[model samples]
Target: MQLNIFELTSIYLYITLAACAFYLAIMFFQKINRTRGSGVDLGPIFGLGFFVLFFGIVYVCWGYMHYFGYEYDFHPLPLYKTGILMTYFALIGVVFFSEKIIGKTKFAFTFFSIGCCVYGIFFTFTEFDLRLFTYITNPITVAFILISFLYFLKVKTTGEIRKQMFSAFLCYIGFLIFFLLDIEGIKALLPFPMEISSIISSIGVIITLVYLGTIFLRFETFTEFGWKDKLRELYIIAPNGTTLFHYSFIRDERNQDLDLISSGLTGVEGILGELIQSKKKLKIVDHQDIKIIFEYGEYTTIALITYENLRIYLPKLTSLRVKFEKLFQDVLKDWSGRIEVFRPANHLVNEFFG
Candidate 1:
């Protein structure tokens, strides 16, 4: 059976969106399981993933409807899709913000929810005029996307993730403009078949999915370490419970007891592993309202004791672990546990992640 352009586009969208959803789920799972230093919660991303899947299904149904020349009006649909999408994105902002004042901002979520409700109700009672409704919702959709992109720009110090996200947002905005123009009956101005516009829109969505997948999956190399004053203490320990090196803001004897802290943390690690039945290397312990974070290296494990938010300090910790393991590979092999040999590590702490 020969498929029309719309059907083929829908099939491609289905495949693309399905892949996006699957990758997002996998990323979230891996993120939760990883023993990284930072405690960036990947839970909020699930909302974005589900949104992609829902939109995928909606596109499929919409294509079939067009293919069969079947026309039906679902007045709430426009509001629902856009509103819920903005809501999901707002939630994502919370995850990215994580413990920041903006992350604590419930206003965005509240505003989006109210907008969706009002838009849904307005569309339900009033006639669904694509032109008029597009006029109302399209700007809001574009503004939300632009604002999200701008926020990402402002907060992102590492150009890698920022660049990827910025590219995705650009594509999404292009697709949005095309979609609105098509709805406004301006597709004829394109001087090309409408099918070409559809193809371009699909391409935009696909590119957006690719970038989002890459950024959220932690596949990018982030050189910009933003943890300046957040990290309180860091320790590198051998597999045999020997403390290789440690740095702390606290100069007292109590904080200098790396051996005691390492042993205790090791024991806690075993108990937690057995309890959870998982081998994740990252561990966070709360004591006296302070966070104790652990990140494992090849022959050593790094522990960070900090009062700062885990989400903010984790990536820096991970960088410290990697740099230490690589720089001290030779020293780490011998039986000697001289803390003086790792003196250069202090410079590392002061330079890369300080």
Candidate 2:
């Protein structure tokens, strides 16, 4: 039997969502394995998988209904609006747990999400109307797009700001396509099937999933520690023995190695001071069951201490030191000594060596 456009589109969308969800689920599992002991929060990445999985289930249901020739208005399953609302909720979770936004901005996003959820629930109980659903969701989607764009514009962090913004934009445009398809007269403009809405929107979602996958691949928030010993502390010190930035992976206060490292470096600048005489780029000190690695730059010095014999990080330390000096050359020269000027160095350290 020849298939109608609606049936074809529904089948395509169902297959696409299901496939994308399956792929993401596998990636998420591997990501967890990859970051097992790195103390990295996997919530945001899990949310991404859940978001696609939730919508995939919804699309399969919708596809089954369409395949059986059950009209949405008459179908017993009132899943359409609820699915979209929950999808938005999932996206909100992604944004929240990603640690991309914090402070008052994160709070504002949370507040807006709650408002939308409450509003969507009210209408779902009362009318469950598609038009009302679209109207309510459109504003929320647009708000997400705008907020993401604003974040991308305002922030200078190393996180995937552009990818996040573009993903939100794709979602908004996908919803727009879905909305336009349901309009009274817009259907006449397209000679194709009304189900083109599903096709277009599914394409948008597929693109979004692809983008997210790329973000996942490029993600370096977590590092695999094959052994029990792990990197415990990292610090950048200025030429004047000033602490420019400090990061500690060891959470326990009892582990005073970080303090000792700082104090020892402050007094003599042992490895840092030796850089001029030895003319060496990297130095390694294995002292008292800890390995301290130093990478010297023209204006700044980088120090890393780890319990493990992780010799592979020496090159990374050198690269970080070089980038730090180059990126903060002007500030290093002026040296007002206010630590705030080097706040950005925190992000650099985390991104490059954390």
Instruction: Please identify model 1 stretches exceeding 4 Å from their true place.
Output: 1-42, 68-102, 107-110, 121-131, 156-186, 218-230, 235-303, 306-350
Per-residue CA lDDT of model 1 for 227-323, tens digit only, reads: 3334577778888887888787655536357788778777788788889889675478876547788887788888787764535467767888888
lDDT values for all models: 0.57, 0.60
Cα deviation of 229, candidate 1, in Å: 9.0
Extract clashing residue pairs from model 2: none
lDDT of each residue in 72-156, candidate 2, tens digit only: 3344345555555655665555455333333335456556665776767675553336446656665665566456545543452
TM-score (C-alpha, index-matched) for candidate 2: 0.57
- Estimate TM-scores for all models: 0.55, 0.57
